[model samples]
Target: MSRHFETAPGLCEARDTATNAYVFNQTMLRIKDPERTLDFYTRVLGMTLVKKLPFPKMEFTLYFLAAIPDSQLEQWSKDDGERLAQTFGRPAMLELTYNWGDKDKAEVNYHNGNSEPKGFGHIGFAVPDLAAACARFDSLGVTYVKRPEDGKMNNIAFIQDPDGYWIEIFSPENLEQGLSEHLGSDQDQR
Candidate 1:
């Protein structure tokens, strides 16, 4: 036997007024080699390296990447401080934290959160064309955890990053089709 859980109710109306201004920002990941990780993200994934901040005293650096449109990139501020402020203001960015001297070490200093004691699952990206994106990834020799046609959820695919973090990929059309079919099946069950 199995159990179905109901969706959690929304927050109180009073709280909505205070929380409406909140915006979800970036997710940070610890990287071993900044060069390799940056190459993978910027080259393979087509993300723009918006800002890079080095802290010599702290012995760490922060690299911010975002999937901003090329048109928007063209209009970005020429001033360094303003550009950084713009990067900070944007949502849905990826922050890679690179500790000094970690790249020189033979062993990875941080866990990818998918092995042994698992915690953070994965981050996802929505592409315009799933098939073409997967094909491009194949050409680039990107490691796949699950191909689009591999399992029950054939509409989605998962690929690994340089640090072994899983990145889920799917297109809007496929996601909508899958969701509609799933919802229809659930309606039949009810």
Candidate 2:
């Protein structure tokens, strides 16, 4: 179905002509350093790695990490894949296959982020104690980007990784309200 729409720099959105409307469906993200990124997602964000598929020729690994719902595990195990995802991924269940290194060098997961004359704005990581996390970063000489602040958030802060990529240290709870606010209307966060 060639729906000739303005294509973003990344992959084109698949479509259906019968409805002539944008459909929300599964999103597959490709990333570099899938293992490291997967570890970060699971450890720092409390996600569980439910699946792993490695492609040596592609020098990449696909990891599916989902934040389980409060429902009984028996029920989820009995549910269909599509249903499980719909119930859980609505707010978030972002997936990725980070290649960190392909063949000799990994392909970029263009979806990661793009900065104007700079690096990614930042990716948030959940931490128990902002101060303690900051201290650890300090010990490793990770550049301090910002002191933890309320930011209208329960607690959050910014930091720069060794590669100069911006990182946000935040609690999962802090995002609940902000997310709802963004969904409410056209509020320019940027």
Put down candidate 2 lDDT per residue, 46-119, tens digits, no spaces: 56655566778876676666665446334444345655554444444455665635424543335324465554
Q: In candidate 1, where is summed lDDT lowest over 10 consecutive residues?
A: 1-10
Pick out the ten consecutive residues of candidate 2 with the lowest summed lDDT.
Answer: 103-112
Q: Model 2 off-target regions past 4 Å? A: 1-29, 53-60, 69-75, 78-90, 100-114, 117-145, 149-155, 159-167, 171-190
RMSD of candidates 1 onward, in order? 5.0, 9.1
lDDT (CA) for every model shown?
0.87, 0.56
TM-score of every prediction relative to native:
0.87, 0.45
Against the correct fold, how does model 2 do in TM-score? 0.45
- Candidate 2 clash figure, as a count: 9
Clashing pairs in 1: none
lDDT of model 2, residue 19: 61
